[model samples]
Target chain A: MKTENNRAWFLVLPVFALVAFSAIVPLMTVVNYSVQDIFGPDDRVFVGAEWYREILQDDRLQQGLLRQFVFSFAILLIEIPLGIAVALAMPRRGRLASLTLVVLALPLLIPWNVVGTIWQIFGRADIGLGGVLVTALGVDYNYAANPFDAWATVLVMDVWHWTSLVALLCFSGLKAIPDAYYQAAKIDGASAWAVFRFVQLPKLKNVLLIAVLLRFMDSFMIYSEPFVLTGGGPGNSTTFLSQTLARLAVGQFDLGPAAAFSLIYFLIILLFCWLFYTTMMQLGRGSQQ
Target chain B: MARIELAHLAHSYLGKPAEEGDYALRPTSHVWEDGVAYALLGPSGCGKTTLLNIMSGLLRPTSGRVLFDGRDVTDLPTEDRNIAQVFQFPVVYDTMSVFDNLAFPLRNRKTPEAEIRSRIEEVAEILDLASCLRQRAGTLASDARQKISMGRGLVRTDVSAILFDEPLTVIDPHLKNSLRRKLGEVHRESRLTLIYVTHDQTEALTFADRVVVMHEGEIVQADTPQALFERPAHTFVGHFVGSPGMNFLSCEVDGGCAVVDGRRIRLADDTAMDGAKQGDRWELGVRPMFLELVFERPTEGVPVRITHVEDLGSSKIVTATTGGGNLKVRVGGEEEIRDGSAWVVFPPEQSLLYRNSRLCGKSAAGQP
Candidate 1:
């Protein structure tokens, strides 16, 4: 057998240079800022680990981090299983199947900021449709003044906008399965629940893992939607870590503290994502053996 | 095991039976004896699979009852019918070990742990998969996965019947022969009712004890392999049951002789025309293997023009045109003939006569 060889690295050199210039340079700048104390633009002092210490001691950052964890966990709990169920209900072949897919994918195509803005108006207690309906139903429906109402509105909006992504992924996974599997399940005398548990669920593991990780990362770093909808208002009840970081860096121009917070945020996401990826990959390998 | 019966079963995918052609499967009645191996043989779109599905309770017949052991099960679900089915393609859980795949049905029924292990071992050994018991089923080759699927069906000994729907179609030709032989051995050892469905006549004839020939949504004949070949109950059966099939030639019956395009072929007995009138559209059917090729001029033989000759190692299939229609004759080795100049004869006793597509009785001299 002849082994073919070619030089393809030359073509990718420019992309590598561009990524390093944009990503590495900025990341180093953040690291530099994170450990320094700047009295002004011209005078700066090297204060190693001082900002890190401040960040750790700050109670507000801790609250933001806790809220971020809870929000991401809650989103995952609601989306993954619901997506699988919807995908199972979808038709397998023909025009109806494609049409259902297109419909499910519509919400995902909407820009994240636009999604937040739309829900902001839609959830208004005094003028919007959601507010009018809730008020007419003889209930107190004030999202502007109530922290619980604001959080609930943000969570529901995120579910509505993103659950379809998980569903679409799961739908494709389910479609890839041949009809022979179901036929065998039938002949094996499997109950409906058993079929889903043994055949369908195990098959969907890869897709579900992807859905979980994507939704978790997105929810953890959520800023645009809640920012537009509630402005992290009602006394920081809806203020997540991303929103808090933005408030410090862009809102108050505390670049040093914000850069420190950003590193923590990045590490947290990287940690969780790594955990999710390794766990799923191990599961996939285990099944193959 | 239970004797399966289909009573006047007919099916149509259309909501209303608008015309005679609307039915996908025409009404017919047949009985399958318990513990007997049967094959439903037909071409594509012949409703053989549909009938098998109906029998397995996967598809309810549009009309009529399906009885098992004299009890109507037409409305029963597949799980309640106690049937194990192997499909055209392999279907096994990728995450499960081969042992688990074989033990799945037993586990579903809550079979004891020790029994599950023993049964799984038994089935795996039978399928030559004992060494791969702990490996995941999905990582194996397609043929191995198919064996796992077969084992899953065979592992359960309590099922009333095992249904195989073209299970060997996806297997390699060499592996198919071995798997088929293994299936025969397993069938003999277990004596479970087996219903094999296939479009390939070779597989059907070699694997089945009683072959059911189906055509155009109806069964034309059901009998042992020898009976189907020697005494076909319908013209379709004769054409569908043999390799190269039966050669059909158009003919007309006069007083005591059947006339082809222009030549009069002698009949062994005049009673072949007992119920036939003159000028009736008739066809004479003969198997290629039964038609003897003559080297010298012989009396009472039809003249033919040899068109093509295909030689197998032990025999030669000679294709010839006679009376404006084509016929195939299988001659033994060492008999040589030149294409376009060879002549042949059809043994009168082995010929079958047909009228309006149904078998008019056998030739009066009888089929040998």
Candidate 2:
């Protein structure tokens, strides 16, 4: 027979109550606003999902959602593999390894708005070093007036700023693998690619899952860098879901539909995160059998 | 299938090693006959792993040539050495099934698919891993995983040799015996050259026919396990090979006798007699199991006061003292041993003489 330990629940009551007070209250208020037509603080009418229906049908918000998905997908495609390659190439021990780790962490330490501002000035066609070099190389390189160029600049800026976070996470993952695995792989006569596929990759699953979650959430909800850099671009080509939500809520002063749009945006991130987590967990379970 | 000859092999971790003390493995030339089982036995940090790694092609010797079947292979990497090695810690590709884990080396070597199937199944069966062939390798208990580590080696028929570096270090005591016996069976059935490295004397003596004892980065003695037990060439071997170890007593030279603990121990031959009379000093070596303890005051034995008798289930270890120190004597449990005065007899056949920590006297059990 097992003894009961229900007394431990009292110790966890504070954290649970704190989460309810801080998160649940604000979230319920957002839910309340999402369903009603708000004229003032006390003057409200029960619209019953009208804002949800209207927000979902709006072409501008739909375009923003599509652009948001593509941007996040491109970020995952470019950063994950490049980060792993950089981590693998870095030294694994001694003074050089420490120096490399410190260097890799530098880009991640820069605040988002500062990174956006630096890239903004750096992309000017006249005085910016990068823009002048590209212009000298004989290409149309104006980011402020061209939608395609603004999109490219924002993508490049995000890659430059955030790829190191993935690399640092992966470097720690690689360090966790013991030397015996490499020795056994050598004794097994495995090729270089085979070692990565069978040994290193399998050992890095947990870290990769964490990296994917963090990067996915960060990129899907991204706003500050693009807001500071492109400001939704020349034609709305770079207007992502968060920028569209900000336009409705703060810029245009449309509160009800904006609340409904923000809730839908939160749900999209939640759904994708659940899918990624379940898929990874299922892969882990499949390997155990 | 192939003889291994290590020609003047030496290794040093330092760049430009200037002295003999810098070497991890001192310079030595040795040969391992084909299809013979040998164990390199030593305490930790005694160059056992260094020598094994050199032979396995994992580490290059600082100065030497390694020849397999008279073909020079000192420059080859571990992949081309065609030798199998099981590590101290077991390694298995987690996502792979036990069958695939066994087939990995075979597939890398480009063996025929038909051959791979039969070979993996056969090796897996031999390792008693047939039931879990389809299960993931990482899902098994450690002993099973260790068996998979060895099975990967067994699946390859073209390997010149198989090396095990303390393969049973992580195994439970009850299972260690079965694994060792299985290894012995595998060696007999396959007739493959096996070089096992270990620090445990019992494991070395029981697993291999020939035990190579190393001390301080050099091979001090390489001989039959029986010979190692009967007559150890170095004092370290004498102290390390047996439980409670062999006893040593300093001797004073006298006419035709070496007096130790105020008693005369007969000299074996004139070679030992010359050393007893002229050498700086001589010491008599005898195993506790070989030292007979008599109950009475015998005229022909060394006098000792019986301090204690330890009754181990099957045998009794009698501790006696004569010259300000203890002397251990092992006798059968049925043997009558009481407290107080006793006599210890050293047979000329079993008593060996050592000078400078090395065997100097000619004993009956000297190497043939």
Candidate 3:
């Protein structure tokens, strides 16, 4: 038998300390705050699961949660495919590739609030070029006056600002594939579509997973762009979960319900992430040795 | 199967090459015999792959034409070339099953589904991929994946030729032989023209009846294995095709003698002192197997000082310093060398003469 050694355990101690300070401690404080009614630091009373029950029963938050899911799924459906298409259409190499990359990265360089403000004016239907052009094109386009318009404006704004992330991720992934694959495909008499479906799509699995998860989380917790562009306005049509949580904790100062709501929200996101990761990993496991 | 003629073929990655050095493949004209297996042997960046690629239509040569059975296919795309190539690294559709991977080319060519199935079964059995037919190709080990890649080429019954560019490079050392044997068996059964490219002399010599030796983007010599062994057209072939390869010693030719380091060694009585012998460069080439070592001084041979001995089980290779150079002599297992100073004999019949890096007078015997 080999001799046992516990020395390796100490090497991981720093990581544990880091997680405790960064996540575990903060999460525990939130948990502590959620279970107690804190009128002030000195005045407090344990309320059991009352905050959780109240938060779950909240009508506005329920609508916000539903809206959040719709928004997340909507953005994912549009961005992932659009990003892949953009990446596919982009030049493979040379000066044009550099120019396209810089142009695509321009959206990501703008701050979230600035993107929101830019669109807010751009969707005005009065002085803004975008709004004026659309109105002149005979479409009734006004983000401030209609709930559907506000929602559409927010979705469009998010796509414009963030689709580049997925595209760039996929671009780098596509570049990493060896030239031999394409040559082999050519020799095999594979059509253009067949090459994409078999060689490129399978190779892009891991990158697409990362892109999807990042897009899901970001879109689910979306707040700044929609807030600046629509102000959760036109009858709360664009108010997502993050906005609801913010209003609870800061706007109404209902920290107890907000903490409980956020804990539930965090668990939901974690659950979906786990679901996506496991399903993707298990897709080809059946045929593997 | 069809004969492939590469007529005045040349390629340079540059749009317009200004010099010979710019070419990846120097202008070459060669005709591959139908149903004959050939190996293209060369060092790295020697344009063997470029030539193979040109044949398979993966690359378009800057000049010349490729004729398959007298049909000009120089401008054809790879799909239209009706050829297949197995790459150095394994290339398999990650999501495809072994059966599907094998049937991919057939499917692309619109072969009947039933025909594809039967063809795959035959190739799968040949490659021993029958057991893994239902398994995902990407999940298999590298050897299995490579087999799948090769099976794709084998499934095509109508291919004019099949090209392999260092196909066994990624296989496990123990598995390379098994795969090579499987490939050889397939080639014999299919009898399609095979152009196997490799830097390994053993792989080329053992696999191909005809071995084409290349150097620096040019075909140095194309002949049978025995011809390459006995009479290499160029010195590069002499140095590239043997186990230890042929050894060369610089010398000057005068009448029927080769003067080496101020010592006169008699050449074969039939040595031709005509045009080929009058070149500025002269060297004598001989394989280790042809050189003999004797303790007593021989009147016909030169003297050498023994420096190193390597025992290779069945034979011993003795490195000797002679004529301002070193030569290796292969000795049989039972032979014993008793002297550090011995007379190294170059057998007249087996010895080769090279002038300007080519076989002098068409052969060692000085026949025109």
- Predicted structure with the largest TM-score when compared to the true one: 3
**Per-residue accuracy of model 2 over A56-119 as CA lDDT, tens digit each:** 9999989998999999999989998988888889999999999998988888888989998898
- TM-score (chain B) for candidate 1 is 0.91
Q: What is candidate 1's CA lDDT for residue A30?
A: 98
| Model 1, C-alpha of B69: deviation from truth (Å) | 1.9
Show where candidate 3 strays beyond 4 Å.
Answer: A1-4, A286-289, B262-273, B276-279, B364-368
Per-model DockQ against the true two-chain complex? 0.56, 0.65, 0.66
TM per model?
0.88, 0.95, 0.96
| Candidates, ranked, DockQ | 3, 2, 1
Residue lDDT tens for model 1, B1-368: 88999999998888899876888899989998999889889899989888988988888889988999999999998888988888888998887888888988888888899999988888888889999999988688999999999999998888888999999977899989988988988888889889999998889889988898888998888888997887676778888888778888888877766678776766555565677766566877779998877756777577778878898868888888876599889888668777665456767777766666655643322221
CAPRI grade, predicted model 3: medium
Could you tell me which 10 consecutive residues in candidate 2 chain B have the lowest summed lDDT? B359-368
Q: What is the lDDT of residue A187 in candidate 1?
A: 84
Better of 1 and 2 by lDDT: 2
Off by over 4 Å in 1: A1-5, A10-60, A89-111, A117-146, A256-260, A287-289, B268-280, B339-342, B362-368
Candidates ranked by lDDT: 3, 2, 1
